[model samples]
Target: MEIDFAEYQLSSQLRGHEDDARGICVCDNTGIATSSRDRTIRFWTLDESNKRDYTLSKILLGHTSFVGPLAWVQPNDEFPEGGIVSGGMDTLVLVWNLVTGEKIQTLKGHKLQVTGIALDGSDIVSTSVDCTLRRWRKGQQVEEWEAHKAAIQAIIRLPSGELVTGSSDMTLKLWKGKSCIQTFLGHTDTIRGLAVMPGLGILSASHDGSIRLWTLSGELLMEMVGHTSIVYSVDAHSSGLIVSSSEDCFAKIWKDGVCVQSIEHPGCVWDAKFLENGDIVTACSDGIVRIWTTCHDKVADAVELDSFASQLSQYKCSRKRVGGLKLEDLPGLEALQIAGTSEGQTKVVREGDNGVAYSWNMSEQKWDKIGEVVDGPDDNMKHPVLDGVQYDYVFDVDIGDGQPIRKLPCNRSDNPYDVADKWLIKENLPLSFREQIVEFILQNTGQKNFTPDPSFRDPYTGSSAYIPGAPSKSSGVSKPTYKHIPKGPLCRLDVTSGVSPFQRLLGERHSFSFSAECNRHDFSVLCVLVRRNSSDWSASSGFDVIPVTGELT
Candidate 1:
């Protein structure tokens, strides 16, 4: 079905957050409410003189770390002007009085960052990176349980009062009260964003670079593709219009699962939303919140539009530069025939005197042209140096034209996801770029098909290449150091990080490569025991395959 709406145009930019805006909520009547990495929640109100403009009204601070998720409540006796609920990296959920902008309650229990929040009447439901869901009533914990085996990243409540949770496990679960009734599985990566389509179903945006529509019954209705990178957030308007934002620096609008418009930005778009009146609002990594409107009267003037266009052009100009690279040695465009392991994975092909960059759109199974490739291009040294640290790769990240070039150091022994997360936090960059930076590290470092460490998941990455006998990170308990004892004599063996006595998987997420070259008897008996919290796993290792026979203490 075609969306019968006017084309969205730039309306106005709202600025106040000291850092990148991460969340936006337009449900309140006072104005727009947004959460940011600045550890503050800001409220905006419309200007009486310039009706299309919004001015800062209030700033609420309570969380000690970056705030991300938001929820709104209607006015009641407890909150005369409605209320605002927010979650943050401080692992606390706060409820604020919309009118006074004062924190009314602070709920604490999560051991990790809170990823999602929803208001259930007078109760508040929240999901966290701790892989659990907690419910609170009257500012007191009412119920809590393990929601997923991995970190829960997104959550939404259906009109029928059922709850849906999306997790780093690459799956969505439908819940009623506290029981999971259905599980939706299709996304190959972390599920980051969730929203209801009202009459249609539910919509999910994922790190897999695709948006999916699924019925409550667990049937995938449609998979929408077009964003060339990690999709951070998605929203739906009652008119059946869907809008999504991505690390690709584009806010794409989709109608019937087909991309109808792509609104470009100078930096990553962290979140997007639709107002009841059909206007669109986008929170961006550039420390600006932009409002797009289909109504001509609300659009910005000619001079403002031109200024935005010039800024976008300037960004593209500085984003890519051919440097220290020989064109003849570059891979041709035919190199795109083989699929990339992840979405937004960049590939540079030799194009005449320059090497053009292309981003893999996994959902479309095609490569989309990004600008020219940048960085060292090809630093094939034994080890790259960054700030006195030797690394397998060091990537130069171009955030903007005037900013200093940021160096992202990576070692083959390090997990790309962990590296990206730490770098983003250290540099105070938007958290939405975690997946994008991971892809960049994987592409430039040539670490494809890397296994992900399931233990410490903050919105998971990598493939399902599990190393046998490795401890699951989500267990939340201490892991036992397992040793392999052979019946013969003890031999000195080279040991790396994860390498056990004889042979073991070294790195956390790296591929396990074991070479057993000891004096082989006709048959050798290998006993492996892993004990933790009164549970034990015993395995028999043979030439054929290591199989877990039973449990022992």
Candidate 2:
């Protein structure tokens, strides 16, 4: 299917886990179960107020270690109300009655940590770090056998009733009843994830950062490589799409061996599963269970509006740290009011007598004023102030468009020449404009320089500039300097007696010509000159060396 993967947005975030969420599974149409390193399993249901959002229904606590895998039992005669089974690092598998929030059974036998579990018909099959696979029926071990030489990381049963297990030994073994049928070998590292793709084949994800497709009989079909770190989980939907989560902090959707969509996570994604409606739920190391879906209707307009408000609040908090005015601090502000228009736009207003309104601008990615300027010229004009000082006739200019505008402060009562020079240095104005603009501001302000600073530092580049009549510490070197030179026009040096001809032929040659202005700075410059032939110089590349307090113009 041609799905617009880009249309997939975060539908909701399930926040309850106290530690890393290790596994996630869709229990039914509206329910999801997540296991965590916090030693608890959380049950969440679609929020009735907003179906896109999930609220914690219950927390099932019993496991003493990290709960890593979970499987749902289909409702049958044996499990009339159908429960969930979880395996974890404590080497214990616990079966829980989902409705009652009670542990129904604790199936134990593994000598080490249980890594994975799967439901085969009415029986539960689990793999462990003890390098063994055990079959249990109704809380009792029915059968057990050696599955791998090393820890078996994952296991799944095929539609043909054959069991397949992947291990740290870097091989997958297909088992029929108690005898091994075929072993598929390709991964160079531990196989961390396994899934059965119905009519397609078996898909295996490994610590080698690769996913391999194989037939039921053990023939490798295709190798998918994209993740830079270990892949932890792989799950397939009935729609012929496969999703894999990895330690690379992303979950990827693959179709016919091609990765179609990638969902980025803030932390390592431990598990991802598709819900009944094809919505995806991911478990992450950030202790968040996030849902991503192409279904936009899942998230109601009100919920999305609240999310936008939350983002704006976070932005306001960030602005407070950077010394910017808040919306409440605006002119005639009382309470901040926001509304959504019918045209899918957001409008925000400062509620008061002289309140201002702003409309969301999607194109500019910011809020734009809604009404025309009504204030008179005198009211619209604003003087620049900085550090308790104001500058006359100096207006603030917004150099960073769409970003917070910064004010340039200077002493207004001070000599105009002195303030202008300091402001030019602080604003990092070009050296070429120092004479014209400084003199113009001084003449207009009608002030004379009583005391002028001779040495000033450029704020942006941190470069020091010295005035013409300034005293210098050394002769001919008034300030730190930087020079950019073109290294070209190659000339072959004569090979001396002790010099090897082969060395001269293989060595690179470049000549440096320094100007009389070079002795001002203490720095080093390394240049590389490439020659296409003995006489033809192809290209040259180099960089200028500047002092720590100096910058190149």
Candidate 3:
């Protein structure tokens, strides 16, 4: 399917615990971790479709205190298999193997409650309420740093062998080991979170509802003000994107100090991070994590809630505002696609093959249509094909910029005349080419049983590309991974406005190359042959394919 990135949709929700949730982490593998005020941790797998796609993967006991912070140990270039590391008010940091639910070695040294933890390689760092920071090496207590005079809320390691800590004392401190290197004091309230951009120094969030950019030498570089409420969590992306979750119940993204996107929730946002694809993932107090993409020329240019603006730098500018609206009950809404009729009605398309199209009236009431394309022929005939399709050359021609498209020679599946093929055309093919393309698809595609469902639309890209495997029920699989597509000749149509969805299947979706000629208004269909069941191509090792040298009608 050709996904339209113009809108966002809600995926499956991870539900189990019932108390106010604090932190959420969508693991690189496995499932998601949700921590609640109920003093419990719940894991939701993607592969199950039950009342709650979650199980008590591990009910981390031993914390005499409520869980305050959680972080998933991502697979490093050093270690592909990852684990989970969590911290609680008990002042303890525990590492657990996600696969086997086995607790790794525990390091104990913090006198007060542990607030947060950060891990890199075999080195681990923790901040605590006792106003101290400790670093632990693989199998030993490496060092401790008394860098803060008050409770240390957050800490981040910089590339310059320095560590930056944010504290409730309204200041950010840079540290080396047991010694403080520099102190940045500017925020009017408590410093809540800190994020480092590697070579770009550090960014800190504060209860003053602003973020400050501080140099490692204690110099204040830039002050960002937008959050209407206290900023609790701050995460920095390598692509100059900084995300902050606040009590304002929103997660905002800033690009070099200018607010770009804001995602709102029903509850306070506790944590947010920019994914590898420039998308933001935020955890809210409502027991949900939201995912938002960065689309240009959209509502992404809006400034964050400017509750307290006096301390902000002059670089803050208000630009055009576009999207970023809160859709209720959809916590982790990530990917969005929009499709509609040529009338340009104000209707949003949600994912699913429901065989129906719903539009909202002025009052936002659903006005349902039988399907996306409704007014066509009945179960029998008596319909019109929007695209110009010749019955005989139906499957051979792809809707193009113009008509009279040519066809190429290709081998069809073995069972070309199977009953399935006949049923597919009768149901899927437009009345104009029902009989013709039905025969052509059978002749060339080699699928004798190829029957087009009235509800079936050929996939937009690639060939032999089947749907991905669903999540396993017990394995707690949550994310969908891309499947391999075999090399093959694929066909596509570039129908102009008012064209039908199923113009015809003239060629394969994936191929090596092709050329065509047609007029501006004349839609020409194009097709290419693909190698069947080809192996996947890799960066180090490419694959050979059976290249089709000719064209198709």
**Maximum-TM-score candidate:** 1
User: What are the per-residue Cα lDDT tens digits for candidate 3 across 362-408?
Assistant: 34333434234222333321211112111112223554556554342
Kindly indicate the candidate among 2 and 3 with the higher TM-score. 2
lDDT for 139 in candidate 1 is 90
RMSD (Cα, Å) for all candidates, in order, is 19.7, 21.3, 24.2
lDDT of 3 at 196: 80
TM-score to true structure, per model = 0.61, 0.55, 0.48
What TM-score number comes out for model 1? 0.61
lDDT per model, in order? Answer: 0.76, 0.68, 0.54
Weakest ten-residue segment in model 1 by summed lDDT = 520-529
Q: What is the full ranking by lDDT, best candidate first?
A: 1, 2, 3
Error of model 3, residue 545, in angstroms:
99
lDDT (C-alpha) at residue 235 in model 1: 94
Residue 311 lDDT (model 1): 76
> Which 10 consecutive positions of candidate 3 have the poorest summed lDDT?
317-326
